[model samples]
Target chain A: MKALRYLALSIAAVLFLVPFYLVVRNGLVSEAEISAASWTFLPSSVRWENFAELFSDPAVPLVRSMVNSLVVAVLQTLGQLLLCSLAGYGLARIPYRYSGVMFYFVVATLMIPAAVTFVPTFVVVSTLGWVSDLRGLVIPGLFSGFTAFLFRQYFLNFPRELEEAARIDGLGHWGTFWRVVVPNSRGFFAALGVIAFVTSWNQFLWPLVIAQDQESWTVQVALSTFLTAQSINVHELFLAAAVSITPLVIVFVAMQRWLVRGVAETGIKE
Target chain B: MSHARAFWLFVGPFAAGLLVFVYVPIGWSVLLSFFDARNTVTPVEFVGLRNYADMLTDGPFLRSLGTFSVFAAFIVPLTFVLALVLALLVSQISFMQAFFRSVFFLPTACSYVVASLVWKLSVFNGLRSGLANTVLSWFGADPVAWTVSTSPPWYWLVLVTLRLWLQLGFYMILFIAGLQRIPPVLYEAAALDGARSWQAFRFVTLPQLRTTSVAVLLLLLIGAYQAFDEFYNVLGTDRGYPPFARPPLIYLYYTALGSGGQDFGHGSAGAVILTVLIVGVTLLQGRVVRR
Candidate 1:
């Protein structure tokens, strides 16, 4: 039984990692070998220049794009965490009339498809003169209904005695939230933080719509440019893709524990 | 602070964001659907249902709706069954469960654009040099234009399969969570009663996973309706060939923001219609789940 389980898991793991392997291998191989009938798992001759070529390529601003992605990811994650936690804490802790109504309104936003909002959001961003700005990319994403919902659910399960004790000590609402509540919810925060980071990092459509300037293009947009460029360099394009995704893969590995917990919690609840 | 005051304070920022970012946009879009909005910065003139009238008479919009319905009809069931089977298989494996789970979940982490691009360039490349064609050549079969061709509907199958590959892992994880919640003793008792593996799953697992199955179905339906990136990336705005594979959202996107031209009014109508369909489907699914 144990051996069977291990075999099944091993097969699953291989299947999952095969795409990553293909991507990395394609990145390393020379352009000639890529179109060949059969290419070895390990490249016969490593093309280390592919990495440098990705940055130096005049058409695509690979380095600028990476920095743009990093900035969006960091800003969106921080803002989402703060806003979501505050709203979630209120929903979980405060007993007030119409709270349920407000909560439902938040949940309703989750159902609104991005396609429905895309053009109008474009209008809003354009009107605000934020069309090619990093602020446009990060600010809208900073507050997510899904994140608020997740945090609310997590906070609902948190113990209330600490907040009560803080209150008894004459701690104000803000003081209680910062000194008492925030400290106790580290795990929940971490879990939500990883999710927020991943979502912001992998975001494509809004960023694509808003960031018209190449200087502010995210990595995904930059990679798309490579794919769609007038002169398509398959080797360089694959290498750029591999490079762009490397950070995300690393982050996923690092935060696998928190991600798993978040997924499991959300799945079970839903 | 009073409870009402505190609640208002707490909800203020988030509410404002949601109103501006979500509700206001939706309201504006709905309003725009009644207007004759053009690319110019000038004020939009109210045409009051002319866009909807145009949509009613529009052949391409109807075709897109029909194509999208067909895509969703095929994709939802295919994804659900694949996810359910994979979930059941992975759940029964006790050792290295986390490894399996992470492996399945990895695809979910990839953006649709990335996955679609990867499949387009490398996996489903039309030329003989493509991965799929190369693999088929070893089997003494001819190369297939997986994305380029639309005849025989095999191209649609490739698109659906790619979507399934990307989405199966997510639903599988959800199903696995649902499966884990079922008490082991129930399975053990069923086994003692001489229930076979398939029988045990049918009688025990299937009934227990009803709510999750409904949720998964609803999610899949919404996702299928909202599928723009995959279709947009794979099939460019122009229907390059005879049998076009453009989904509704793609059509909406093209109508609204395509390089050819922008017709915000018609596009808004399309979006509104699509949103209503999705919401209706979701609500019906929710009712079914509750029952």
Candidate 2:
């Protein structure tokens, strides 16, 4: 019975790992090898330059897309961290008349799926002349109610004595938040930061719609173009997929514990 | 500053963003649904309920709803059972637990577009070199067009497997969290009461995981309704969107953006319809869960 369980898990693990393996194998191999009728588990020779070739490809503009993705993800994450945290802290800590209503309002926004607002949001962005611009990509996604809710839940449990101590030491609300709360809540921030960054990096549909030109496309959008653009090199497509996910894979591995805890908190804490 | 003043100072940016980005769009969408705002964003003609009526009666739009329902029926239960089983399996094992957990959860980090690309091009591509076809070749079978041939609807396999691979781990993590929340004392009590392992899981474990299961199920349902990225990537081509498996979002995408028709009225109408369905289902589920 014990052996059976291990075997089952091992099989499942292999199944999960195969796509990544195939990606790497095909990514590093020649286009001819990728299109070869005979299947090889591993490439005879791994070409490290396929990624460089992908970057050099004129049609893809992957480097620009990567930069756009990094900019968008970093700005969006930082913005969400600052904005959501402040809102979350306010909603949790401050005694205000409309606080309850505001909290519900944020929660209501969470329930409204992006599909419902996708078109009108486009219209709003275009009306603001943000089409094919970073503002369109970055600004709209900067504040997420889900992240705010997470922060609100986190801050509610934060020790009040520290804030009181800061208050007594001639600190205002802003000072207390910066001096007392922000420093101590690094773990929570890091967890949410990683989540936000990964989410922004992986965002496809919005970027696909907003970033019309190749110059403004995010990595996901750039990758999608490969699907329709039949002239693109096959192995380069695999390489691009591999390269696009590398940052996220690193973040996922490095922040594994926090990511798991954060996800768990999102589910179980509610 | 006063508490209220400080609160606004802190939350003002988020409030402004939420209002501008979320609420305004929703309001605008409702308004657009009532007008014939085609080839332009500005309101052209007052169509009243014409857009809504047209969207409701549209064959493709109705088919998209049916598509989501079929997808939800399969995905929700499949993910729940698989994730629960995975959680249980992982929880029981003492050695290499973290290793297995990470391996399973790793794909959650991958984007849907990249996953769809890999699935379409590498895994299930019609070429004999493709992984699925290669495996078939080993069994002396002909290379079958996974996405191209709709007769057998083998495309569902590609879609389901890709989704399962990407999402199973995340749900599995949630299940693990849920399982961990089930106290050891409950299991011990069940054991003292002469319950078998399966019986303990059936009664104690299942009952303890009620909230988590409800949350997971609700999330899965929402995820199903909001399914766009994978479907759009895997099946959508330069030729046009595939006739089969077009979810509402995709249909709306075609109506509003992809088709170049810019039928904002009908698109917004469809969006409102979808929102109503999602919100209604969520509230209904909430009531059921609370009971």
Best DockQ among the predictions, by candidate number: 2
lDDT of 1 by residue, B1-291 (tens): 887888777777988888887787678778888888877322389898889989879798889878878998999999899788778778777666666777887876776667766777777877787777877888999988887775766668667867877778878878887887899999999999999988998999999998788778777877787676666566542333233777776676667777777788887787777777777776776677678
What overall lDDT, based on C-alpha atoms, would model 2 receive against the true structure? 0.88
lDDT of 2 by residue, B75-112 (tens): 88988899998999999999999999999999988899
All candidates: DockQ: 0.50, 0.74
Instruction: Sort candidate 2 into its docking category.
Output: medium
Quantify all predictions' global Cα lDDT against the true fold.
0.77, 0.88
Q: Give me the candidate number with maximum lDDT.
A: 2
Give lDDT: candidate 2, residue B116.
90
Q: What is the lDDT of residue A229 in candidate 2?
A: 58
Q: Residue by residue across A1-270, what tens digits does model 1's lDDT show?
A: 667656766776676676667777777778888777663456688888788777777876878888999999999899988988889878877889889999998888776766556777776667778888987898777668877888888778778888889999998777888999899888878877887788788777787778888888998777665554425577777777777777878877888888766766655445
Expressed as tens digits, the lDDT of each residue in A62-122 for candidate 2 is 7888899999999998998999999999999999999999999899887777755788899
- Root-mean-square deviation of every model: 2.5, 1.4
